[model samples]
Target: MTDLKVRKLPWEFDESVPFQWNRENPRFGIMMNAVSFLAPAFERFIVSSTRAAMAQITDPATLEEADAFLRQEAIHGRAHRNHTAALVKQYPGLKQVLVDLDASYDRVLKTEPLEYHLAYIADIEATFTPLFSVMLNHQDKLFDIGDHRVGPLFLWHFVEEIEHRSSAKIVYDAVVPSPWYRLRVIPKVVAHVMGCFSMFCRAVDTHVPAADRGIDACDMIVRPKRLTSLFERSELPGQFEGVPRTEVITMLYRLARAQAPNHSPATEKVPAFASEWFEAYEQGKDVVNWYRPARVAG
Candidate 1:
């Protein structure tokens, strides 16, 4: 029901490659380190809160999916954590960034009630769905990835993000129950804009050498021109194209009210994109990229 079959996922949270990659790849290393640094700050809160909040969910299938989500997110967090630990072994100065960010972000989130957490999730999921889905659909356009391991990892995570994007919003919107909640997402958009800059700058300062410190942290993985293409090409606004995707996605809740058919893998199954497609996403076998840029850091 929840599509939990692991597809070509890397062995459970390997630290060797990412950690070694960090030491070798300065730009990517710092970017990813910042990801781990800020993750415990904002995302740890979300994952832990989401895990707890999910217990109240009654739908057996959804509950299972949330558990899977918890597992997936925890894996991601750990990979990033190990990456940071590798950084700390090299430079003890880096730990302060995580410490400061966690304290500040937690202080902010702690002041808000459950509604704020739910609303933040709703907005984030809404923003993420269309973006990842579109790229998963359009696989051929992949640019030069330079490295073999990290590129496919990027695409795999991207596909899964598309798959689960609606789940959080579906969960949160159930309780928030406001059309205004959709519009309220505008401010939440700031998190990406602001959070990226804050996290990246901090990481660069901590890790980049005094001479090359001028170089941006994520530039190697995220080429500048492509970054622009990602914003314009993803066509996320298309979900709101004729009518809003949110409007249709909201049906996840209505499914309960109307007593819709039960969710089953028989009905909601995945093909084995596990082969070549998942790496760059073959059109047919991979998720039909829902008709979307493609991008990320850390």
Candidate 2:
């Protein structure tokens, strides 16, 4: 788990910071907040699923990694809960959207088999691993565009997400160990993630007034290049687009393959800055000093 550190972050959100914090891009900001709204619950799911599997594993190294993963997730969930609490209070209607997400997660937790839960963890973590890379690679641009205070929370979260990317797969393979089982479960997991993402976007758009709304990217699903840029750059005032359902599914296919018995994800390198940040933390140095973009030679 790369020595996962449970750093106490200063995460405080309020109406003073616009709802669309990312360069005032309404939909982008909403999408980011929507993810935050669902994060605490989703992280709790990860913790429970991983811990349940950890109970059955016998390897000491796996057990240690599992413990560290749980601690990091526990802190992550707390930070997100605090932020989301602030969000729902500002926009009361968002409570309903979060309720819907909670209901969906509850239904799965109560009905699905243990393997399904493990598969879901592996599925989402796989997606996050590469997604984190994209964010880290473009952090300077993203942070510059977004609210500075909120930026560190995301920076901290995604860095740790990359650090523990393999924990779920490690636990999943230990327990399930069947390629056939993964193939069946992976699609279902992809469907769930994408479905929830769509629901969150719609919910945010519905409750947030048009005057406050940024460009809606929902209509641009077919444009892959634009969608790719969404992750790499902040959207300007007039440019709004999103990832297509088919493309998300295709990306999930590749992510799932990386979780296969003998394969590795092509984009597995953790960003150099993120590595340096955590390494500094381990040595009791001020990691905030390393969060800035590396200076380029002119």
Candidate 3:
């Protein structure tokens, strides 16, 4: 059996942390903050979508995993909402965008067919699960780019994502077990998520001042690059400590292709650091400070 459980991590978002939390990489900070901006609403949707499907699942183990998944997502939403509340005070534009997103989710929950919601949740988990593994595997490298609190919050989130990677797939299979249906939904999910990310990035660029833009963190992925001389240099955000730009591009491509009939969450390999982090958790160490510069050796 897969080792899956909802972990109650003690991470408090420092309200005093600046909007340009990634001191070394402002673009990364913007992209991360954009993710934070979206998380509360996105996660709430996930929890609700999962709960809506719960009445159909009868397997005791699957039902237990689904419950844990819902608990984890709820906590995740609360944490991101708290952090985003602090962020909106610095960048008020983000709050409006979040409100709009919340309304959009509400509309979907109220009107969309149940299968569509389950497909979105399942495909998104499959796509993000591997990317979260990359983040964990490369955690040490990312430690230097952000404020002490910032990187760990993301790492903590990614760790739980890894822990419950199979829960959504289990629910998806239970509720909407049609490959053809899933295949149609995967493309829509990828396009929707990428579109949302692009919108968030542009919103940041529009609202934040120039000196703090950092690395145009995610624009390179969304827009085509113009050829430039070596001396001209690229403004793209640097790769997360250990993962390369190529790996990210590859992951995005795989996400786009994840609807293939052969793909299954059961076969996705868990990252080494995820296991290491859980062992530390089991040992009762403070995970919130897992990526502190003092704790990590260069």
Give the number of the best model, judged by TM-score. 3
Give the per-residue lDDT of model 1 (tens digit) for 100-207: 676765765677666667666555544444444333343333312212333344455555655665566555644555646545554654554356456556565656
| Per-residue error (Å), model 1, residue 69 | 1.9
Candidate 3: the clashing residue pairs are: 27-214, 27-215, 141-241
Give the per-residue lDDT of model 2 (tens digit) for 1-298: 2355566765666666556677544444665676687787788787888788888899888888788887888788888777776767777787787778877887888899889898788767777775665556656545546765566677778888888877777777788867457657776886777667777777767776655556553542324356454344343532233344454454446555666655543247667867766877678764332334432221
Task: Estimate the lDDT of model 1.
Answer: 0.48
Model number with the top lDDT: 3
Q: What is the per-residue lDDT of model 3 for residues 1-298, given as tens digits with 9 covering 90 to 100?
A: 4356677766666558777787665545676787787787778999898888988888887788888888999888888887877777777876777787787677778887778888888777777776776666666655445777777778778778877877887888888868678778666666767666766676767766656655553453454353222113345544453466667766666665655645776667778987887798899777777656465775
Off by over 4 Å in 1: 6-40, 133-144, 188-193, 210-214, 217-298
Candidate 1, backbone clash total: 5
lDDT of each: 0.48, 0.67, 0.72
Off-target runs (Cα >4 Å) in candidate 2 are: 24-27, 217-257, 264-267, 280-298
Q: Tell me how many residue pairs clash in candidate 2.
A: 1
> Which is the winner by lDDT between candidate 1 and candidate 3?
3
